[model samples]
Target: MILGTVLGLIIFGGIGEFSKSQKANSLGQVKYLIGVSYPNLNGPWQLQMNKEIKNEIARHDDTRVIFTDAAQNDEQQVQDIHSLMSYGIDLLIVSVDNASTLTPVISEVYKKIPVIVLGRGVKGYDYTLYIGSDNQLNGNMAAKEAIRLLGNKRGQIIEVEGNKESLQAEERSKGFRETIQRESKHSIIETINGNWLKDRAEDELKNLLKSGVKPDLIYAHNDAMALGAYQALKQLKIEGIKIIGTDGLNEESGGLRLVKQGIIDATYITPTGGTSAVQYAIDILHKVPGLPKKIILRNHEVTKSNVDSYLTEGDNSSIPFIKKKERKIKLGFAQVGSESEWRLANTDSIISAAKEAGVELILKNADYSQKKQMDIIRDFIKQKVDVIAFSPKTEDGWEEVLMEAKNAGIPIILSDREINVEDQTMWTSFIGSDFVEEGRRAGKWLVSDSKLTTTPLHIIEIEGTANSAPAVDRKQGFNEIIQQNSKFQLLQSYSGDFTLDQGKKWMKQALKTYGTEIDVVYAHNDDMALGAIKAIEDYGLKPGVDIKIISIDATIKAFNSLKLGKMNFTVECNPLLGPQLMKAVKDLENGIEIPQKIITAEETFDQKQSKKEFSRRAY
Candidate 1:
């Protein structure tokens, strides 16, 4: 098998050359030593994950990987990581056996080197990047398939679960139970732990059957467990109970083959993301642009109808549903008003990209009003546009209008912001910068820059529009870092509405109230930072010298200010998302699924780097 061949290479330490340069040849290509930590390699799923990571790393010549297995023991995993650290590995790729027990150690290690988490993630955003399939969605898909298999009649289900310590198992079961209860006439009557083993599932099923409880359907957390239940049914001369499972592996003895042989009724394709982990590790090491904090792999359901195509095509979920004649995709984009240079650049990028991609763009500006944005979306729905994209004014109140778009069969893509909705599947994907990470980068710059003194530093913040995703997330991310250090003191924050006028007004008030007491000014965007600079200069104080200024949204204006030594630091929040948005729209039109979140590449700049980087700024 491919996995077996890869395993042989991994064991023998026979690294190969790159099959294809994954990215542009990075400068200063250092031979990096990489460490991989695995929970266990006991099952086909685990083995496949290991194989993919090893195979991907083998393609790159400038990297060497050393792996350690924890044998499913959390303590042993901790020890394995410590050993890997002792080797001074440049990066760490880990799949935790248990999140709760391993998070502290992983968090500690992240402070030193980049950590890429796979399968299960740690407690907080302590790692560099995470690549995994959504486990909750896995259960949701299984429950959906169960409802379809059971049809109209109410059905009783027996659920065979994985290890109790596994967060994936808990989330999968929770999603399955909650979805079945809320969306359909189905009940999970009996829940038993199979410990993620086929034999265990078989033994547990025999006991459940002997107890004289008959279920209409059996749902297992994995394909092995589902196949185990099938074995129990065969031994007891029982039939007619539908089976659903997760991890639709394509091997001969895997879920795809089993379903093809009429063993399991349905299975969800839960990707391990092992190859993605390695590929993204290289990207992170190379400091690639436009990398997201999280990459949620797409998952789909496989049944008798599409299993053959799924197996044959490998990645295409369903055969492109009856091909339509080539036509321009009409994309309705409801933008947050051109409040600043960043917003205008974002709008221009979208328009230009739409033209380049041949998409018929129906654009509307919300003018900084959530109500107006909702009206625009309603209008788009009425117009029956092919796709609707919007940068939400606020995170709330979007669920209802988004539901309207979803019900209208038009996919919604969130641009430059996010929304608070009960069902996240309401939107197809979110494409933007990680506002939280941008804030974190700003904070990190302030703490590390040698110009800032060790004494207590007083900070005044000029914020964006209230309740907006960027404002809220940026505050949380910045505060998370600054709160750790006692030297930084945040005096007061002013709400600026992300406008230069409001920023200047608030800065004037702050200058009158606090006077020369403020040592730093943090603005959410470039216009606000410029406004603060004007306020400081008007108050007879040099902007970047007297008051260290930091801001987000690294626009050309911000870059120029950085070069002029007016703004000390500016975090880049790229507004040029037109290319990515158009690509996603075209992919959806072609019946291809995109990731749940698509983050733009961003960076930070100081005065020294501004001149060199200024010429390359797209926004």
Candidate 2:
């Protein structure tokens, strides 16, 4: 038998001898085939798992293992499994595509080779061990965190569920629903299938928003889906909605970093599946019995308080703020110029922040001109900057510039205003305020305050630039609230063009025509309100005393005015976007794809609150 084994080794190489030794030694070192099913290889979890599986295969010197990626197809995965069995593989490891459809294939494979299911499991399978995190536990943990964060508030939740067909998805949804059901106080009013894609989630969320579903909390099965939900919330301008998700992969930073940055409230940890699967296969190969049929790894909840410990080495602050050792990267910026003081501050902050962060910035002022911005972008392409950052002056007229940037192999970071660019593949990520939420907060506040009043209040609105995104959003948000109130009415509205001069001129004319009938002034920005205040003073009407003033963009001037009782409420629009921009650039350089949009955290301030923080104010 030994001689025969040696001869087999000589004839068919080491693989043949390994097979012979398996039969002789009674170790049962059967040839095993592994099949991986994934939606995309671009995500962090898939990439990590692929690397781990490959490493495990290298370590298994005595057994032959065949690997295949199903690439997110149920039929393709079944065919791949059939092909593997045909190659004489003794065992099979499968991460299923569709739990239900793959049941038949798993049953078929089990007749030939013991099938071990990893990450996700199929029904009617009892052939092999299962190793993966408890997804149901993940859902429960997410719900606990959501309830803890919400405290006493009872509101509707929007569930961003994973792919409807996957068992993991079903299990997670089941867990979440069970937990919410147990609570009895809170309810999941609607659940949208995200299909485990960010873009898909965003679309579904946007549709729900347009249909007027007011969600107080959003729970996504995965971090990417959560990010998509965040984008939709921002675009629709919904405010005060808590967002949570799962998955804690290190490479993509997962939802942990998002929570730290206030983009998400929380995320649950889902262990990577590859390493566990490989270990299970090896245990079976060695004839190790008494192995637990099912291994469910515990889930961990990650929140803002404990996220810093999980920050990646590159993101660690111990490293100098900017990597001074590397070649200086030239960055181009196309900005929305002087739309508001906050806009100006945002531009200045990026320029200063990039420098502080050790990047050389080549600044270009679009001056709120889309044509000029396009020209500047083309010039930046000619200059071959490493990366480009721009705040689109308008939603349209950006595809050409974005295409040109993409052709140049330059990654683009969108700041503030979002573009109507159809090919989302053009930009790396967006970092800015939740414009719609800002509007919604303004609206909610207006409604709450107006509810206390007995008499009807006539309001004149000072709108932002006609074409600007914030202008359109702020108007929509204000009207969404005011229209619902019977005691509040908008007497007149005019575009201030986001300029003090335009605001002053427009207000003066409205004052001349309407006289003292206007009870309040709502400006899209603080600069415009300051101008409106001037117009009010010129007309001999006490500014805040006679006509209550409310505006967005709590610039220093605006806050100071609020403190002095000249402005009633100034919603904060912080222009400090430098940190997020630099982080995105670094993440891209490290080969990580950024999410579609990142909405900055914001708040509202009245005269009373402004007085407390006036001394510590930065902008």
Which candidate achieves the best lDDT against the true structure?
1
Any idea what lDDT model 1 has?
0.84
List, residue by residue over 1-619, the lDDT tens digit for candidate 1: 2242244335634446322222213532436777888877776777789889878976887776778877677888888888778757789998885788889999999999999988876776788888777788789878888998899998999999987777788889988998899999788899999877889999999998999999999999999899899999999989999999888899966899988999998988888889888888998888875567777776778889889887887755222221343777899999989999999999999999999999999999999888999999999999888899999999998878877877777788899999888576688888898788888888888889734677888999999999999999999889987988999999999999898888899999999999999988989998998998998899999999999999999899888888889889999888888988998888888877777777665667899989999998877
Candidate 2 segments whose C-alpha is farther than 4 A from its true place: 1-326
Global lDDT scores for all candidate models:
0.84, 0.74
| Estimated TM-score for each candidate | 0.67, 0.52
Superposition TM-score, candidate 2 onto the true structure: 0.52
Clashing pairs for model 1 are 290-601
Candidate 1 TM-score to native: 0.67
lDDT of 2 at 461: 93
